[model samples]
Target: MSLREVIAQMRQTMASLGGEAAVLLQRLAARAIRGELRRLAGAGSRVWTPAAARAVVDRLRRMLVRLVAQLGAALGKALTSAAATSLADAALFFETGDRALLGHVLPLRPVAPTPAQIALAREGVFKASLGRFGALLVHAVEGAAVATVLLGKPHRAGVDHVALALRRTAAAHAWELQRIAETEASAAYNAAQLEVLLAQDVPGDRMMKRLVATFDSRTGRDSVLLHGQVRPVREPFFDSHRGHFYMAPPNRPNDRELMVGHRPAWGEVVVDRWPVAEDRRAAPAPAATRRVPGQAIRSAKNLRAGDVLAAPGRPRIASVAERGGRIEVRTEQGLLLYFAAGAAIGVLAAS
Candidate 1:
């Protein structure tokens, strides 16, 4: 679709993503635009580089905030002047925070001027190219939210203009992030998985019956349950104090842990879904030969790091190095140790 269509869709999506999240998206959009502008001046390109994307996002965000203001004004007594004033303050915060993100989270690095100004110039170009994509993500989400809010609900004339805008923007950002992750880490993550399997192939006494791994996507921190079977999540997943990993099962007002099917194994890596679902049926377990929670198992060689050891659990990986024949691992307690190669069983990943 055209750029204008994409922008329109993004705005609708943001409107639906209400609450504090909408505000956050708007804030990021502002930052994204500034970052984009900086890159454009450096590259002399009109194409939607990360910087250009950020610019589009910023436009969407400003428009969303304006829409909110307009709605409040139209509502008249429905919205007090105090409420409007607060919303305006919120908009202002979004802008200021965006600037801070640019300055702190993504700052341009200066390169030494070698061969006079040529090396410096090259460095500048590289920095702008590398840094602009992040800015674009910020822009896309923020802009889409604004557009979505302004457009209001969807209509029968095909898609809701605002929702479509937000979805497209979100899809674009998600695709970009996934692409970067795959390009940079896919091979490495795969290789690491292989090494883990090999380490689990060894045989001996003191060998762990089940090899369990845990990980957090947000902070990129991890833990391992060296000899545990994969279990489904049935109990409360507590948050770790070390801040290395998170386990709060989304946000559910009822305080009931989201339980559907078999419980996730302790330290197993499962997709962290929040809000207890209506259904409680359990699907057939994955083919990876995982024991039910609390069951003991023999050794298998197919397990790998990054492969999800999940059932109803925190989506985790065997976050350890398989150097030589041993699995050098760090436990949840922050203690480092080595496990024999033959102790590990195959892994149960998210299919």
Candidate 2:
């Protein structure tokens, strides 16, 4: 058939499709041009070599496949599956050699989940990792190849889809293992705290307050004060700082007076020596200056979110309202807290 006929046929076929017809036509047009160039080069004295034409066609085909795969993967898992055949057909359009053909297989993307879906996914990941690790460890000792592959980092496969899947599976296992370790660690922590509380000479209410405070210190309660001497102990995965307090967590250098005067409303929850607030408003304090939006505040020079903030001799954070210029903040266990300029002291306008 004539080149014009081929071009006309391609145009008619492309016009029939909706949406992505333009992109598809472009690919077809590229293939046609490559073929035409191959024909023209052999005609004149300055004729192109067969190998050169074949190479050009091959490179164009590889580029076209890469473009399609990148775009299709973003459309979600269902589109990837549905367009699998079309993707394969597009790959075969400009077949000049085996090497280019080999590179056209598209990688599929995993479907994203909602927050609840992610939680469920994480649970499933944990179960799968636990099951795989338990079952495979025994085989690893016996020199099973499968065991090695499962434990190893991601590897490339003939198809990009296979490699992508393996990477995701490995990631899931790592995350689940981390979560399991944290749960076991938390259980051990609670048992130790229980023993400490029972042995203390303080009243039951006071002992409970101390326990809550200790828990807060070890968790993400960076703003809590350590009234006495608190020192770092064993490192905890979740805590930025780990320490035990003899008295109370220290207040920030500038906010010490305000925190010392304000009493905790319902005491605090303890991680190690830090005290987490039961409710910001549980024990009422005077209305304070509200931070303005978009204001930039400098972080404590020496302290970080996980560092143990302690008073002179305390092992945990003290239940103080304001120490120095910084507000004492106590957070609940397992919650990730992000501190910003306006969010530091949670004293909202009393309604």
Q: Could you list the CA RMSD of all candidates, in the order they appear?
A: 21.8, 28.8
**Highest TM-score, which number?**
2
lDDT of each: 0.31, 0.28
Segments in model 2 whose C-alpha atoms lie over 4 Å from true places: 1-168, 171-173, 199-343
Candidate 1 lDDT over 1-351, as tens digits, reads: 322232223222222222223233334444444443443334332333344444545655565454334322222221122123223332332234334333322211222221222212223322342245444544556555444443333222112232355445544554333232222121222122222222323333111111222122211111222212212121222222111221221121111111111111112323221111222233222234445664334332333445443223433444567655545543333333344445443234422
Per-model TM-score on C-alpha atoms: 0.19, 0.22
* Steric clash count of candidate 1: 36
Model 2: per-residue Cα lDDT over 37-58, one tens digit each:
3443343332233333334334
